[model samples]
Target: SDRKFKEILSKSIHDGHKIYEWLDTDEKLKLTRQLAHSVKLIYYLKLQQQLWQDYYDLGIKDGVWAPRISK
Candidate 1:
């Protein structure tokens, strides 16, 4: 799954470069907004993956633990 995710991320980034080379100014503005949203989505996915990893490392077998963020 991680490999697949990496492949998709790589392809998306490559496609972004291609788009940037061709799109006009107006389109680039719209793309900038979309890219900002995508960054947030990526952040959320990484946070989720880290939470799952922490749970696994803690030997949380039962689906009863609530994940909390550490400052």
Candidate 2:
């Protein structure tokens, strides 16, 4: 399932379109939800990467993972 999701994401990223080819309407909705979830995670990781870099630059070794203040 993870590999399949990665494949879809890679194709979508390269092609600049939704990854819903060959799927029925219901299946397309489900795939859309899955893709949205994956996108959220990717956004989160990118934000975290930026935060880590900022912290490292400031020499901050420890900090709490506060969701409300993340963005």
Candidate 3:
């Protein structure tokens, strides 16, 4: 599952135009759920705590930047 998630994420980032064009709303939701589940698993593993912390920080930053970016 982790491997599949990473593969999708990598494809999204590396070939975003093609990926986004092909991905539908349901597929996007499924991917989001998969990513959230993966994050929970990583938290349980206790090996990616700092990475999770950084992701949280970035989420905060993105929220702050979102309004400006949307314009």
Give the TM-scores of the predictions, in the order they appear. 0.45, 0.48, 0.32
lDDT of 3 by residue, 1-71 (tens): 54465456656575655544444466675877677689889877786777777777897888843333553
Instruction: Give the lowest summed-lDDT range of ten residues in model 3.
Output: 62-71
Put down candidate 1 lDDT per residue, 1-71, tens digits, no spaces: 33343344446675654543444366564666577579989999999999988888676557566556699
lDDT of 3 at 28: 78
Which clashing pairs does model 3 show? none
Off by over 4 Å in 3: 1-24, 47-71
| Clash pairs detected, candidate 2 | none
Model 2 agreement with the true structure over 1-71: per-residue lDDT tens digits: 64475466657675534443534366665776687889899999999999987877566435444334554
lDDT of 3 at 21: 48
Compute the lDDT for candidate 1: 0.63
- Global Cα RMSD, each model: 10.2, 10.6, 16.3
Candidate achieving the largest TM-score:
2
> Which stretch of 10 consecutive residues in model 1 shows the poorest summed lDDT?
1-10
Model 3 lDDT on a 0 to 1 scale: 0.64
Candidate 2 achieves a global lDDT of 0.65
